[model samples]
Each structure stands twice: as structure tokens, then as C-alpha cells.
Target: MAQRMYIVDDDKSIRVMIKNIIEDNDLGVIIGQANDGEIAYKQISSIYPDIVLIDLLLPSLDGIEIIKKVKNEINHDMIFIMISEVSSDNMITEAYEAGIEFFISKPINVLEVVTVIKRAIESQNLRNVLNQLKNTYSIDSRKNVTAPITNSSRRNTMKIYSELGITGESGCNDLANIIEIIVNERKTNNHFNKYNMKEIYLELNKRFYSENSIKTIKAIEQRIRRTVIVALNNIANIGIEDFSNYKFEKYSSVLFDFSDIRLEMDYIRGKSKQRGKINIKTFIEGTINLLKD
Candidate 1:
């Protein structure tokens, strides 16, 4: 589906650069733009974007607050990526707690941004797949089964989520929440399947845009593997001796190409020339010290 995205930043150049890449690469649709925190929050709540690219510091509100408040009030399973100069460990943790998918430090790298956004999208989809299985299976396990005794779409969805490594992401939880929202929407709207990616873009645009601003149509594209790297990095923290573990094989090989998880994996872990089956033990005792300052 053509994903929907919004950019909230003060710098016109940065906005222009992002617009060019998104449009050139054809990542998704841009519904609106906001210059600061307050404006962003207001616009986002009303528009309900799939992903939000926000700067850390803004005129009215800071980026952190934007994430905090949006997550708090709207309570949607939206993806929030922080692009800022802030490097405090506390701030990073806070963003995670507030439900941000990833943090990109300033002097925003276009290539990096592209990569991150793409991973986020794939991760988000996986999140949806995972949640649907939880609902269908959890219910069938307890309440249904004898109620209908029909097809097994839920099983298929769960397989996709596991195979996709959507279960491995911090944002996986948020994605579940989003899937719930989509499911509810589907119940009331009979035309849900009729709305393909392009239709999804239009729906987002109509919700976010009340006026016709040319700048609102700016394009945004992703590198196709940025967030996957972040996901792998997070998984690495879970544990890995070399790269032979199930997690390594899963992220590096199985789930690698969804959004091209390779970019994010390469970015998170140092580059490895060897591709096929890895040789390291998956359980390395607290090797994170080497990764520390």
C-alpha cells in the first residue's frame, strides 16, 4: 500500500530535501506539514498519519513532547521517528517508552532516513500481522472454535508475522494497537478491502488536509532498510555470539529482504563479508561491554 507520511520540521531546506527523496523514490503520500510541536500535534491527531517524521526541537513544542503527547492522547499505533541532535541516553529511552520506532541523530542523512522509514513501514505491517493472529487465535483458543469452525486465515497471518520478524521489533506492540484500530474500522466499513494502497493514500490525505497546499504534496521515500538495522541492533542486544543463532539467521537472512533489512542490519552491526550460515554462538555472555563507550 502507498503509505502515508507527515513531516514536521522548521527548516525549509530539510523539508525540501525530504520531499524530493520521498517523491523521487515513491515511498508514500504526504498529507500535510507542520513547522513546530503544537502545530504538529494538532495536525497529527486530526490527520492520523501512518508515520510521523518529527524534529527534536520546535518553536512551540519539542519533538519529545510531540511523541509523548501524541502517544498519550490519540493513543494510536502510529510510528514516530525522532530526527534530532539530542543524544542523551535518557532521551532515547524516553522516546522508546513514549512508543517511537527509531531515533535518527541530526545532520539527518538522506540515505539513512530513507532506510529507517522503509524498515519502519515493514515493521509496522508485521505488527499488524502479528496482532491479527493474537486476536484470531487467542479467541479461537478460548472462545470460538465450535462457534464457527471455518477457515484458518489467522494461522496464515501469524506465520507471516513470525517469518517477517515483526515480533522482534519494539514497535511491534504499537503495530498491534494499530491493527486493532484497523480491524474495528473494517467491521463498520464493508469497503475496507476495496481500499487499496492508492485509496489508502487518498483517505489519509482527506483526513489530514482541509486546504490545498502545494507543499503538502511533497514526496517522501525510504532507503528500504534503515529501521530493519535498528531492529537487528536491538535484537543483537538480546544476544548473539557470532551470527549463527536463530535470531541472527532470522533477522539477517529470513526477514532481511522485506524492506531490505540488510541496510538496517549493516548499519546496526558492523559490516560482515560472509553472507550464508553464520558461525558464532547465539548466546554470548554480556558482550555488550565492547559496544559501550
Candidate 2:
């Protein structure tokens, strides 16, 4: 079944533009539209759209006020998205507390709106699946003491990392195994079911690396290492395939500046090009800019 969406905005042109853009992108069925909050409330109560897109500046009642009112009186199941030109941090925070799932700031690009909506839909669908699985499983930790996950979990995790282009991810395969072994050891000894991040990190390092973990923090080191590795890989393999014409044109500039990953990739073509050592910066910065939200 196609999902339903409702749009609420005071300007007719903005409303029309959004509806057309969404329809053009084949996003979903636009169930209804409202010029103000009052009309929006009525349509929402009667039609029950699966998602609601609201502009902050409306005619009578504003979008934020509408969100609060609807939550107080109507159902809270539908996802809410706040669209605004203003960058009022406090208002955005308050709207978040009131249960807006996401935001798209204006001047609204249609492409961005589509991306946000798709991401939100994906999240909601995943949540629904998780809830269904929880109801179906009725997990019993004591049933088989320490039975391993039956191949399915491993396949699923690998598939996920692969889909996200993280096949070369180091920690997911190695450090995580170390941590899992530590947890299993604790469980076998009948230890408590609680462990802090620092304690877990220390235990993992002590067990696997033969060195005490840092006392200062949580999974910060793990995240940094994994992210840096990913950044390095992405920058090196930035262009998925090499076009014969553009290989030495567009990518040559990228390679000339960042010799880290490109230099390594060069060695893969031993017969085609001469060999060279590839060493990415121990501390570099441009990589982070590419992966920023």
C-alpha cells in the first residue's frame, strides 16, 4: 500500500511547489493539503496521514503550536517533519522535545526533502520490524546457556557492513570478537549483567592486546580509528570504477594531492604502473570534511 502524506503551509505557491515536486519524484500519495494549522488539524484527525510536513509560519496557529496541540488532543503515532527558513536553535530543540522526528531547513531543496522523507520512512519501517520481532521472539537467555547465533546473525551483520561499503572495516571483525569473548567469559562466571564502557574497553584491551585500555573515556578511540580507516578507504576508492578517459584527468588531481590511498591503489595495477609506498597522514583533516552530515 502506498503511504499517505499531508502538507501544511500558508503560501499557496509553496504548497503547490512542494506537492508537485513530491509527485514528480514519485515519493508517495499526497492525501491532503492545508493552508493553516486549523484546517490541518481537521484533516489530520479525519484522514490520519502517515506523515505530516509542516511549515513553521502559518496563518493563525503556527506549526510548532500545532504540533503541541495535536499531541495533546489527537494521536501521536504519525511522524512529524518541521520545515523552516529560520535557524532558531531553541525552537528547533523544543520542537524535537515535542516529538518532531526530523527537520528540513529552507530555502527547501526538493532533492533534500525527498532524501529526508525517504530516510524517515526507512527508520519507521525498521522500527516496525524490530517491534514485530520482539513480540515474536520472547527471548530466554537461560534456555541454552551460551549457544552461539546460528549463522544468520553473522550473515546479516556482514551483509549490512557490505551494503554500507564497510567490508574492510577492522573493528567490526576483530575488536568486536574480543569484546564478545570477554562478555561470554563474564556470563560463564555468572557475573552481573552490567558493565560500563570504560570497564568493557579495559577488559577487551587487556584480554586481546595484553595492554590496559585508556582510563579517560568510552568508545571514542574505537570510533575514531574505524572512521579514519573508512575515510581513508573512501578517499582512495572515491571513484568506484576507472573511466579510461578521466582516470588520469579528474582523479589524477585527487591522487596528486592525497597520495595516501591512491598510492596503495596504484600498486594493485603492478603490470600497468610502477610500485610505490602508500602512507596516509597519522593526523590529517580533509577526510573528515567529506563525511560530514
lDDT per model vs. reference: 0.54, 0.55
Q: Please state the error at residue 136 of candidate 2 in Å.
A: 5.5
Model 2 misplacement above 4 A: 134-293
TM-score of 2: 0.45
**Candidate 1 global lDDT:** 0.54
Instruction: Give one digit per residue, the lDDT tens place, for model 1 in 1-293.
Output: 45668898899787777777788888876756788788789878654667888887799888888888766555556788887777788877877787788777778687888898889889777865664343232223334352321233323333434544545433333223223333446668844434443343344334333333333322100111222333344444333445566656544543333233444344334464222221111111011111121
Worst 10 residues of 2 by lDDT: 284-293
- Supply candidate 1's per-residue lDDT for 35: 85
Q: Write the per-residue lDDT of candidate 2 for residues 215-248, one digit (tens) a residue.
A: 3122324432433344333334443354343423
**Predictions: Cα RMSD each:** 17.1, 19.6
